[model samples]
Target: MKFSLFITGSPTSTKACHSALDFALALMRGGDHSLAGVFFYEDATYIANQFAMPPRDECHIGQEWADFATQYEIPLYVCIAAAIRRGIVNDSEAKRYELDTSNLAKPYQLEGLGTLISLSSESDRIVRFR
Candidate 1:
């Protein structure tokens, strides 16, 4: 089976993001499932911000998600409008907006909601983490 995921919770604010990762990994380990994409929307866009700094004791969920995406060959898509509203930006966007910095992490691409729609169309299942 192939699946796409939609995440709407901040990693630090709730366990939903982590739980989704766990579930996706388990599916991969089963050898019969694959993740097509992970769409981060609303507050979940924080997970794609490279500039996020959690306490030393806490795990860096942004990096964790980036690594997972790389390891599993899953595309990580962050809603461009949502992310920009939350201060997440890539180099191009930063330049366009004349920002001093860009914080979008690798493996997390900035896209429109259309990407989510496309994922939903291509996937066998679409899971929401919220």
Candidate 2:
């Protein structure tokens, strides 16, 4: 089965992000299931912010997500509007917005709701974490 994940929680304030990661890991370990993609929306868009720095003792959820996506070749999609509202932007977005720097983390792409729609349509199921 193919699954798509829709995450809408703040990585710093909620366990939803971590829970979603755990779920994804478990799904991959099953070997029978595959992930079509991961969509980070609402507060979850913060996970794509490259400038976010957690305490040294804390887990860097963004980095964790990045590593997972890179290893599994899973696409990480962040809502462009939500991400921009949270000050997360890639080089192109920054250039377009005339920002001095871009803070969008690697392995995460900024996309619109259309991307989510497409992912959902292509997946057998969509698991939401909020």
Q: How close is every model to the real structure, measured as TM-score? A: 0.95, 0.98
Model 1 CA lDDT for position 118: 99
Residue-by-residue lDDT tens digits, candidate 2, 1-130: 9999999999989988999999999999999999999999999999998888999898999999999999999999999999999899999999999999999989999999999999999999999999
Q: lDDT per model, in order? A: 0.90, 0.96
Question: What local lDDT score does residue 115 receive in model 2, on the 0 to 100 scale?
Answer: 99
lDDT of 1 by residue, 83-104 (tens): 9999999999999999998989
Task: Give the Cα error of residue 102 in candidate 2, in Å.
Answer: 0.4
Candidate 1 residue 91 Cα shift, in angstroms, is: 0.6
C-alpha positional error of residue 76 in candidate 2 after TM-score superposition, expressed in Å: 0.3
Candidate 1: worst-modelled 10 consecutive residues by lDDT? 58-67
What is the model-wide C-alpha lDDT for candidate 1?
A: 0.90
List ranges where model 1 is wrong by over 4 Å: none
The most accurate candidate by TM-score is 2
